[model samples]
Target: MDSLSYTPRGVLTPQRSLADLTWLRVGGPADWFFQPADEDDLAAFLKALPADVAVFPMGVGSNLIVRDGGIRAVVIRLGRGFNGIEVDGETVTAGAAALDAHVARKAAQAGRDLTFLRTIPGSIGGAVKMNAGCYGSYVADHLISVRIVTRAGEVQTLPAEALNLAYRSSQLPEGAVIVSATFRAAEGEPGALEARMVDQIAKRDASQPTKERSAGSTFRNPSGASSTGRADDTHELKAWAVIDKAGMRGATLGGAQMSEKHSNFLINAGGASAHDLEQLGEEVRKKVLQTQGISLEWEIMRIGEY
Candidate 1:
């Protein structure tokens, strides 16, 4: 595990603290942290990396929880070189590191509608991986294809259908790192699109705890149960409603509290640890199941050792 072996044109560090890299500010550290100079650098480094080593591709760390014990893997974070956004007629191609909001705004400026991404946090990479959506539109709806560097350092292009995207999930190959994504956007008046994004931000701020140190929604809308406790695939029952029913809306553990403003938001009220945040989320899940008989599924990606 030395830089000489890879000969990378990137910044590499061992035992790097990850707390600052995450939104919640709670993770311990990464075994090794790497910020590649560009896509070529990333592919080259990955090619030289040992097969037994693990790779964790990180976005802006918006909806993640790295455990207190830290990840024993190489954490790769894309930066400036991979954040370009290009518009061509009806298509918008965005680099993996480009912020979702930025891409949305850029598309809107080009008189295209990608307004769905304006309120979503993190980067295009994470959005594609999670199939992120908002306001009735999803990445899957407009995605044409994606470029990725596989774990073995081979670059490949995969069509949108190849991903098998569904309900906030995708079938990306294991250890592959998304480099860019192309989306075919609908035509729209630039002014109209910008106004729509403005409205979305206002709505999100009014309902969600956007001002707090939160990892967005803690759980997905229960996909199997309705509010009446019957099985329903339509996912009509929202996670917050179930949490409110369980009486855990304003629940707290250490400095972690389910935001009073939005029950589904797991927030660091102040000085919270990763353990505290995760434990509180589990507690909420337990209560919801106990009271409503509906098991909740987490939306936030939690990784590393406890």
Candidate 2:
């Protein structure tokens, strides 16, 4: 038997396996998983949930690192009903659950310039949460406002200013759920925009290991404002270069191995444990710091437990 206060029109349960939800295809069971029918069902369910029961909203989990021990909270994931994309004039109003790449294509097809999102394989909510960016354009550059469901079950519209959007971060409440967002897209030729997307894909394929079973860039670019940042190189030294210098490009721990194609990416060759990946990452960081005197910052969001 199971116990949960809010049951959605779709389904509600505890101990739902999360491996199928993430791009990494990893992670343990969620304490409770709720997939409501629509906005109202989601709101009502949240309102009825107990105050002490922690809630965690997740998107497609593209940039997540859920540990093996599992998440001990009610996990709310939006689907079908919350996956619409609408365009009015030059603005795109999208459900947080909508895929970034899909929305990008829709915008491009409609002559709106959002080509930067064409290759990012995550949802709108994840893009907002991570302030996700590619090429030169960033999500923060086009966001207008977003709707959110608070931990206490109240829905409200929040301006970009209030969210305090910054590089790969926002002041999201501990368990506040992003519901939708409006982006002000620019006008551009559909053909040109799509051509640029193809070029972007080719560039990524040439540079990063896009096809391997790995999380994307393992570390954030050290902020330019870091107290003692590196000198401005035409192309700054990324995580890969640093790890390569440390002789960890193809390093391995258990089933986890630093990708040979792109040194920055770490892969689970097969049956790799969360601890293995985490440890491998730490080892790479330690080696890089010891050899180069530069600290690497993690970009992948490691959540849950060990």
Candidate 3:
């Protein structure tokens, strides 16, 4: 790649190992890793960098599996400068790096109901990108608008409608980095909201393998409907049920296993390479297709070379 015309104030590292950066802790390296000092630094760096150089905007790595061979691109990670949260009336604005749980608590403290985010992993950016939802509430239900810096370094605010948000997916302009999001929440008493979130957390911990090394849910429901991915959707098919019927619950290959607590969860029980986890998932998929005749789609995002 050609040298950049401008020098950014941010820290940049070459061939940075990515295992430590991901929740799975199994990826190789990123060709370049950039942590911008601020929004201006990020924009300028993207503007000055060569057009052919790829850019990957990463959240907290909560729902990702970067491959063993690493990413051949500049992986941009937002930090403190981009993690501010603000509340005004029923509207809450949060930076991309702000944790979903933090945003939920802050909004609840301000007497606005965003308690659905309290149990979800990762940041607001990833939430918006995936249309994350829980307890019948979704980012698509509350998101008003988003501020993003396009791959060309042009900043723009787009309405929530601009993104075709649906079940576990949304469409953003390719390579655009989400800087912040604004959500209009319902008004509720702080005490009541806190209580609701507490109950939600208790339920999640009881059902999911919260203490294990896992990347949330492994597969999407096989319904293929475009509506929200609620537990009570019309089609109402669950991935875990299918996995259980296929007899792959608690199944293991190498160090990776489908969690006994939640068959939909793919966990690293001990020392698991990315290959082990991915291959095990593929095996589950193959088994489900062969036995149940239902194809499963991955919910976790996997990237980079293998």
lDDT tens digits by residue: candidate 2, 190-274: 9998999989889888977777667787876653322111221224766688888899988999888899988888887777877
Better by lDDT, candidate 2 or 1: 1
lDDT of 3 by residue, 145-199 (tens): 9999999998999999999888899899988999999999999999999999999
Query: Sorted on lDDT, highest at the top, how do the candidates line up?
Result: 3, 1, 2
Worst 10 residues of 3 by lDDT: 225-234
Question: Least accurate stretch of 10 residues (summed lDDT) in model 2?
Answer: 225-234
**Over 4 Å off in model 3, which ranges?**
227-234
Compare the candidates by TM-score and give the number of the best one. 3
Q: Give the Å shift of residue 100 in candidate 1.
A: 0.4
Kindly state the number of residue pairs that clash in model 2: 0
**Alpha-carbon lDDT of model 3:** 0.92
How would you encode candidate 1's per-residue C-alpha lDDT over 1-306 as one tens digit per residue? 744466788999999999999999999899999999998999999889988889999999999999999999999999999999999999999999999999999999999999999999999999999888877778888999999999999999999989987777889888999999999999999999999999999999999999899988899888643222223224567889999999998999999999899999999999999999999999999999999898999999999999
lDDT at position 81, candidate 3: 92
